[model samples]
Target chain A: MAASATRADALVHARGLTKRFDKLVAVDAIDFDVQRGEAFGFLGPNGAGKTSTMRMIGCVSSPSGGELRVLGLDPVIDGPRIRARLGVVPQADTLDMELRVDENLLTYARYFDIPRDVARARTQELLEFVQLKDRAKDEVEPLSGGMKRRLTIARALVNEPGLLLLDEPTTGLDPQARHLVWDRLYRLKQQGVTIVLTTHYMDEAEQLCDRLVVMDKAKIVASGSPRSLIDQYSTREVLELRFPIDAAPALDGKLDGIAERVEVLPDRVLLYAHDGEAAASAVHQRGLRPESTLVRRSTLEDVFLRLTGRSLIE
Target chain B: MTGALRVVEHHLMVYRRTWKGGMFVSFASPILFLAAIGIGLGSLIARGPVHTVGGVSYLTFLAPGLLAATAMQTAFVETTYPVMAKIQWLRTYDGMLATPLTVRDVLGGEIGWLVIRLATTAFAFFLVMVLFGTVHSLVALLMIPVVVLNGLAFGAPIFAFTATQRKDKGFPTIGRFIITPLFLLGGVFFPIAQLPPIAQGIAWATPLAHSVVLSRSLAIGGMNPSALIDVAVLAAYATLGIIAASITLPRRLVR
Candidate 1:
């Protein structure tokens, strides 16, 4: 798939990469390449080996099999050199709780061997960028979860890395906080920094990733832009019917030919069709009554349910 | 090595903000021990027929032993819970690993910071000894190296063991079973000759006991050439601990 030509421009290239923890294979053979300045994503539920793949690219975990290259260098042999040009934000906050907000960035800069004055100037600018400039002198332990996440993001950009890797950048934050993080990440993407992030949130993937791969059970199930994946795997519109508890499955047989496909969850029946309103009218013509109906456009969640036959959250 | 030094610099930077909380213990503990034990208790023991401990006042004799003991305790304290917190709780090493720093750099930097800490506290305690008139000879200045060797001898091995730990339950065990017992019987309070033959043999095997001998001899200005063997032994322990940490740290960090 144009591997030879794109190899030169790919910031991260992986072919048949695998990771094993004892007898358990966390990441099976997976192949993907992230072009320069593009925000790529690995979207999957928990225990799906997204973190394992991200760590391998971050150069913190070794690949048990196959090959991986970051910034045109092997992760195994040139780890420090490759890591020098890469910024990593781990799933959990690794900010030093003992230091002030600004000291965290300053000490991190010293690891990159940035001189003190330059590091100080960049620290101020990063704090401003993350909107944590007011908390520069305060201790890190007292900051809220959102502030800590932003501080971690700011710390990651201290070296002006060519590639930034984030693992579940907003897993536990509230909706408001998640939106703020998404905004900052969007700005970074607009500033031409390559980003690689993993998330189980379909909305997060749709909001920030230029391209994404759907990973499930240690393998990549699909790869495309969000719109293209939905178009290829799901219909243009979906009709939602909320029936009594556990009754949605019994009615799947009665609604057969009106839609391209039908999915029966425990509490709702989803109909995939070109025109959701027509599907609803057909259901009404069949003398079905006593339920609520809603028609909406398809999203990545529908694409994921179509591809995996399971809900993203469950 | 420069990467390791950067790690050391990071610790130093953190210490700058928090050193005052610990300054009382690091610099003042030695003096308090000198006043309470050396001058206070020694006065009662001086009235006995045996007034001198190997040809010097009891204060002078106990000063260097406490110096070495303080270094040993400081090394152990720095290595155990703090190292565990960095690996498991605080995850500071994980942060460093994401940068240009390697596992070897983290280990080296930690040991280097321990050396700086041990050296400064040992020197400050030495000055306290001088202020109390316990130091009798200029050769006692050699105690600094002995203190540093004694520190690494404990710090490196403890650092290695801490790297392998997932929890801090083992640290209190190290303190109770290992550190406290050594502090009591490692010739810090009195000469090992006062103990029975078997206990003396056990005391001589510990790095703390050997450093006590080296430091006491240096402080008394009666440097025993035979104590050079203690130097070699402490150096061997320090070197082996450093090597062991080099192995275990990478194993724990670079997964």
Candidate 2:
């Protein structure tokens, strides 16, 4: 294929990729590139087509239209070849609950046609890498949610894939568990694994992603480094104001020009500005005192809300 | 070659770890059927003219038929629920597909495992039949491969069904609508000729009927040209079922 020349640097490349489910277009026409050994992310809310796009990249789902390549191979014709070089941690843990933790890793390694001795060695190494060496023999059904998630991550790493796909790696994890997973992922990144991940957590996006695309409703709204995205789409600081439901309108027209942008949410109003404390003081100077006020750095969450209106979509 | 061996190793691992419960059920059911039907129902038919191809007793005549039926039953049970679990509940196929193995390799591995399971169960049943003096001649040895073929006939179709099923609601329907009827009408308990002409014709169409006739004929040293026809029918069923399974498996899994 023509992709071989570019394969040296680009781990994943797509041109006008799109996926449609009958009448519903889950992933609209979009393009992106991921260089080797880079940590990339897809950040969006629920139903933002992140998982669908990941599935396409993982070679599990066929793209409806446009050009897509992974590891310099077409997914439709070379699925197994591409998939062999890819590791996937799906959004929902699809671990084999019937098997022991070690067995799960062993069985997964067998799929790669890895020799028994090699699979055994890799399973042991991965179990240690994910900190599940002690629970290796335990049945997966009895493992805690965090343990299972850790085991799933470990299983994905069994092949030592060149391109690792993690869809919401920290979702549903406790704070301690999330941090533990983050540490492992960071180590993998340092080891020169090219990671493509998707998460709704802004903190997770900021913590792991070297570059990201913010998706909303099946389309890319923006794409850049997290810092660059925040700088390009939003200001450096944010001032949060909380008002009584009845008194919110009294200050609405009074607080204009104090910040670069104002977003009114159900619980609070966010003011985007270069200086959060200055924006907060300006709000008070206009003879309007919110019930509570706090100033912090603007985040991807604010960027998402600014792009996609605040409506709870199913 | 390594791919096929990996599947075999996987099956062997699972069998060694889980077969205690399976062995208990496998031995118990056929023995209970032997006691209840062969002893309880055989007594009523023993007094009547014994339907012998070459001077075998009524219970002896019934034993080979039951063995083939049991092999098919075990194959169906193993291939259906476990196959469905691997596909849906367990997501084993998804995991396997992500590897270097193609969907055809998975199907080959599963069919290979079913053959081994059928052989093991048939061996155990053969021993039980021997203890009961069901062997009329050394010809009963040929019944082993016949029983394996019987398993493939049922296992292939069930495996194909399982590849398409998204839930377990249809499993009982397959048992009730297809398996149970075939068990009763397929001449497991009696000769097909005893049925009315139309029912006999319908019974002959089922793979179980062919299995019973072939196994019983061989058990009493009564092989004939029609045995070739029975073997051909079984081979046809197995080939078609396997091809259909291979074609359907990728469609289901790749989606």
Candidate 3:
């Protein structure tokens, strides 16, 4: 992992940004600053207003209230100017399926008023960059999900944008496909491109994000680095214990002092502790035998559950 | 301006790729209408003495209206479904908006492309009319520009309407309740003067009515001062429609 420099100059700055749909507030007043040459993330589950916020930054959707600046230009008065320097990959793939893969890139390039010859050259380079050179002449419909995503990324890069906004970049891909996309994004970040991404996948957020905000119900509940957030909201380790229905009650208060916190779920109980082995010893010392016991490091998922009181998947 | 031109170019590229399908549909519709209505239905109207305004057959009088009507229909269909697809189904405009092209540029390009498509279809219809002996004098050739203007006038409002649409159910409703009625009453197959006075007044409000009246006048080599008025009305609609689309399209996408 490349070390990211901490700076105060923001490439994207939002002050009390909010969006409303009818009476439903999609994105409440939230403020954040994304600096140059850093990968920022909006880490949230579905319906948390991540996509809405990204759209506002992308200049495709208007913010209902608050101030927003992209590349130091106001999104309302200077939308065209800001959009000229920004690239967006929406949550759903909106590729022009009617055109060939190469034609799609070339057509998008033309929208930026790129000359035909220049567009042609850029299309070739982008095709090779996405590893879709052999499929340049093929229709977009037959390409796999991963290829379509790569093409979308390539299309977003056609104008050589300064900031890239990706909404759920790896939402519905296979494991291998997700890694391929992650690798590609990592390379772009290495080249000093500023990336702002929204993802529900905890691993994706951990792997790509330098700093992130955890949004719930249209508001930012927490914001910090992954490691800092984990340390703030969770212990160093978590021990999971699953017992038979009858034996569960005997172990309820037997290991209270063994951990920092204990959560009793319907099916299982979790012990958040600084040391998992000591917690397990305490549990066994109380003569409570369980069906299964496992000790593992705490993750972002635990932090999300701890803060939101709902599992990310649920 | 260059960005708008690029949008126009992209539309042309798409048209080229799908030209065969487009030609088959656009060309076949008018020929089928000409055959089904003019030839098939004309035989039943009793060999009424050929109405000669400028030494042309009654069929010639009917020709220009059909040409203009066909152009309008082609433009309407082209802008309606495709515009809806770009706004809703395909989301092509959203992708384009990420570039330097403003929403005004997109609207300008789309309307411009509609005019070009209308021209191509009007040319095909004009040739078919000539083959059927319905064209008289060299003045009929001038109907091309007139038909294109007619198309823009009819298509502009439809494009604006489609941009505001969130669903497709109302599309057929508009086509059936509005467009089909205009087609039947706008003097496409017969003279509007032959209708009742109240019906003529209603047809006068329609853009197609102005187009048919002007096209027929040009096709028969008879120039009426009111023809220029009709042209001006169609032009006004085109200009206002383009402006309205430019203003409304951005709100639609950005909101």
Q: State the displacement of the C-alpha of residue B196, model 3, in Å, after optimal TM-score superposition.
A: 2.7
Q: Give the residue spans of candidate 3 off by over 4 A.
A: A1-8, A243-255, A265-267, A287-291, B39-55
Compared with the true structure, what per-residue lDDT tens digits does model 2 show for residues A149-188?
A: 8898898888889889999998888999999999999999
Models 1 onward score TM values of 0.97, 0.94, 0.92
What is the lDDT, from 0 to 100, of the residue B126 in candidate 2? 79
Please say which candidate is ahead in TM-score: 2 or 3. 2
Q: Residue by residue across B1-255, what tens digits does model 3's lDDT show?
A: 777787898897787799998788766876787787767666655365653433444466567888887877777787788899998898988888877887888887888788889888888888888778777778888889998998998888778878888898777887897778878878887778889999999888778899898888887676777987898888988887877777777779877
For candidate 3, give fnat to 2 decimals: 0.77
Which candidate number has the best TM-score? 1
DockQ for each numbered candidate: 0.85, 0.57, 0.71
How good is the docking of model 3, as DockQ?
Answer: 0.71
Candidate 1 interface RMS = 0.6
What's model 1's lDDT at A277?
93
Candidate 3 docking band: medium
The residue-by-residue lDDT of candidate 2 on B70-145, one tens digit each, is 8878877988888888888877777766666777778888999989999988888877777777777888889999
The window of 10 residues in a row where model 3 chain A has the poorest summed lDDT is A1-10
Top lDDT prediction, candidate number: 1
Count of clashes in candidate 2: 0
True lDDT of residue A78, candidate 3: 86
Q: By TM-score, highest first, what's the ranking? A: 1, 2, 3
**After superposing candidate 2, which stretches have Cα over 4 Å from the reference?**
A1-8, A310-314, B48-55
